[model samples]
Target: MSNGYGKKSNSPILASVLHGPRDLRLEIRSVSDPAPHELQIAIKRTGLCGSDVAYYKNFRNGDLQAVAPLSLGHESAGVVVAMGESVQGFHIGQRVALEVGVPCDDCRTCQRGRYNLCAKMRFRSSAKSVPHYQGCLQERINHPAKWCHKIPSHVSLDSAALLEPLSVAIHAVRRSFIEQGDTVVVYGAGTVGLLVAAMAKLSGATTVLISDVDSGRVEYALHNGFATKGYINTKTSPLTELSDKLMAAKETAVDVVDIACADQPDAEGADVTFDCTGKEICIQAGLYTTRPGGQLVMVGMGTPIQTLPVSAAHLREIDIIGIFRYANTYATGIKILSSGVLPCLDNMVTHRFQGLDAVPKAFEVAGRTVDHEGSLVLKVVIET
Candidate 1:
């Protein structure tokens, strides 16, 4: 069947699909035209995130189950190729970054300016809804024009793909309400963790400490100047021991601790804590670490329901705030990328796959390899 794009036959179109756990298939599909409010994008760069990894490794992410064939990738950027009839404010050939999740604007949550929580949200490559929304790991993608934020002239497509994760960090930082001189600690050194640290620093945190199980990631953070102090590899050490080590080195307790680690430990002393890892254990740690009257922001997407430290939270009067995806941060993310405040974009992109045929290999490498210094970016483009 014709995809409506009317492209010449024999052109290669690549896509990634999850047949089951650890089963990613690359195939060619017909490209379609944009709807009235949508824009057709020639996808250039797509970043592999933890969610994509989860879908590739297990065909599931947290409570969301992938019951059918699904495409992978959400952190993506490309150039606009076609605009639907009613689409305005965008033109063909414009570079853009897509906001992966599009919410139904009529919901009460949306009306409340919390559109990220809208019940009818359609997020790309998620099993939360049946007939999953296809992702951008394809040659051409038709997306809502309103959700495509134009990239600044100076921002490269590689860095533009980062806007997706950067928006998450931006939301977490905003939720934490970080103030100048506040000491901040991030629990993970992964992409999101590093971005969180950088965003926290930009938000006025005087000292930012990042911890991770991978020493290589810590080294990357230190080498890239993204972190001030790094913690020893946490994979082998106990949580209490790590905390003690942090205390011994700094000689003082941190005011805020953002748990970016996938796992959590009991945090004893912190003013504000963020559970960016989204695991039950990390959520518990956020509760344990937060001081009285402090806040705990949950930013990670783990199991929908897990045992939480409710009694401790109540006793400590710590407010546990949950963050859905992100809202109203695309423009700010673009600005941040354009301003050149954050660095090491090339360093973050650790591996690159040539085409859609390499997607399965990309997922395999990302799943099995423990490389903390590099990230795997799968490039999906029209074969030149």
Candidate 2:
């Protein structure tokens, strides 16, 4: 499809806007012209994320609270329709995955190749910043051309939209410092968790295991070959008594994960563990499951303050790494997705919505505790 819509029209574009908690509105807003270094893209697909659900249900996620109306959505892919004078290396009709965060290139972090931590970052759909950096839930959006990565012709726009979360997984895997043939365990079977599992296998992990409170997700991971083995947290436990709870959690994981990995009754530790669920119990379970001197990568954004097994980590000398949003991962993520190695990658989209008008219902569906078939909602995509 030709991406160029030609010159801007005087009419406004229909957009999905969030006024506050559970207050979503369909409105028309003036289209923005691309800046000297930007491209105006017609957003074709957007994946509704957990953060979006948090914003929709609570009007806040973590420390970020919405004080003003903001457009909602970040995981998006689109076609470049217009470009500014300074834009280069791209032309009209290019399919691109929009990197939602635009970092200030001059920042020290950016200079050091860690632009994801740029203090002046303007992240889409984030209300933490003043003047509210809006998102791509609109018909047209002007984004920095540098942050837009072109996708392979074989990649569907829907799949391209998922590169954002895949980038997060790539970053998590990178931070774990996984060695070839290392055993890896990923906690949580959500989109990021599943991607982490898939990436771990692709990174040459000897055995990859996944655990989730949702049985369906664990089953999905195992059946889809995302993980070599999967564990379902059949029961919920309160987050207390670190030592006792850690032991119990580890034993529980051993009972399930061991059957899948070692085919033995006894439990063994993984060389690396990834906690994609921010739940306190999941974090403890991941830490407890990692072997001494191994590594733990925390990728989930959960409660700001969490209780951790500090003594265990210190005694075991397990390296603990925390990652915020991804940096320098879009290219690698897109390349991996385009490689067509992940046969089940496209199946991750368990639900889909039609247009901007479906945005609210999309979010509502995304916020559901149970999915359409009463299973976990792995991923939801909105085609605009």
Candidate 3:
């Protein structure tokens, strides 16, 4: 801390703290002024994500568990209220998106511009490192100016918060290296999947087919025009046996590809496939539905180990690409949002709750398959 940071704020800060599983308490604490190269942001919007829900319900997201009270939220946007003298290129009242992960700039991965893969990275709201770096669920926070992305003035704060997940889709599409007129098959119609499909179309994919187990989600994707067509994956049965899963995946792939190009009659598979569901069957289906020499991007994370169809991938010479969060996509995401190329961007957030008190309810709704009225629950936003 330096400069004006020594002067503490008299106004108390409000926060929704996660003490444990399903235990979210509204607490008040004093604010800390921004340090040199830091900006104090008044958080305006925070979107609930699957990872956040996982931590709320199970006290863990995959292998990482929260052993201590940790505020859970990272997809967020805010306004700059204060800046340290050392920070330049930013001023007060600026709208910015918080790039939750902070990586060691000196690392080889960071030097290569793949900082998302940096081993020493510390992402907010995550318990990977002890004394977990708190998240953006609070009223105000101090963050490094470099990690804060200035958003376009015209963009909605909801969409600004969405840029975090949108950046992931952007990174996934970038890894695919898709060319114009390519066909893409996306498994999962969730927020990430829909965003990925939308980005794929915007990236010049002639056909973007999205699939999901939920019929409502499929309809939503088609209605939003994010998908050329939607497929309902009701026949998929979770099987413990690897061979059975493979056979089922192959069958599902054939059925899906048959509908991918209805009039073509001979459309074998997609030029690229993305498994955003992270299900083993979905991964296997991606292998089966990708054309020879094509690429399949694993954008979603699942179990550390799963039975994969390595033989098929090796024989077909299909490149399997892996994505970890995102690297260098915030500026591009801001541009995409500001341009309004995707009109559905505004409707991406299907539910809204207000204030820090509603965060718990928002997480509850986010974890549900559908709302009480049976409406499709997409992104849940907490507006402060």
User: Clash number for every model?
Assistant: 1, 0, 0
lDDT of 3 at 305: 87
Task: Give the poorly placed runs of model 3, Cα more than 4 Å off.
Answer: 1-11
Comparison by lDDT, 1 against 3, better one: 3
How much does candidate 2 score in TM-score?
0.94
Q: Which candidate has the top score in lDDT?
A: 3
TM values, all candidates? 0.84, 0.94, 0.96
lDDT of 3 by residue, 129-181 (tens): 78898899999988999999988778889989999999999999999878998
Q: Rank the candidates by lDDT, best first.
A: 3, 2, 1
Question: What do the candidate models score in CA lDDT, each in turn?
Answer: 0.73, 0.85, 0.89
Candidate 2 lDDT, 1-384, residue by residue in tens: 122445654437889999888899999998756778888889999998889999999899889998889898999999998888788899899999999998889978999999999989999999878888999999998898998999889999988999999999999988877888778989888899999999999999978989887888888888888998877777575646667777776676565446545843344578888999787777877777887898989999998897777877899899999989799999988878878887456798888999998888888788764666786678989998
TM-score of 3: 0.96
Q: Residue 198 CA error for candidate 1 (Å)?
A: 1.0
- Candidate 3, lDDT over the whole model: 0.89
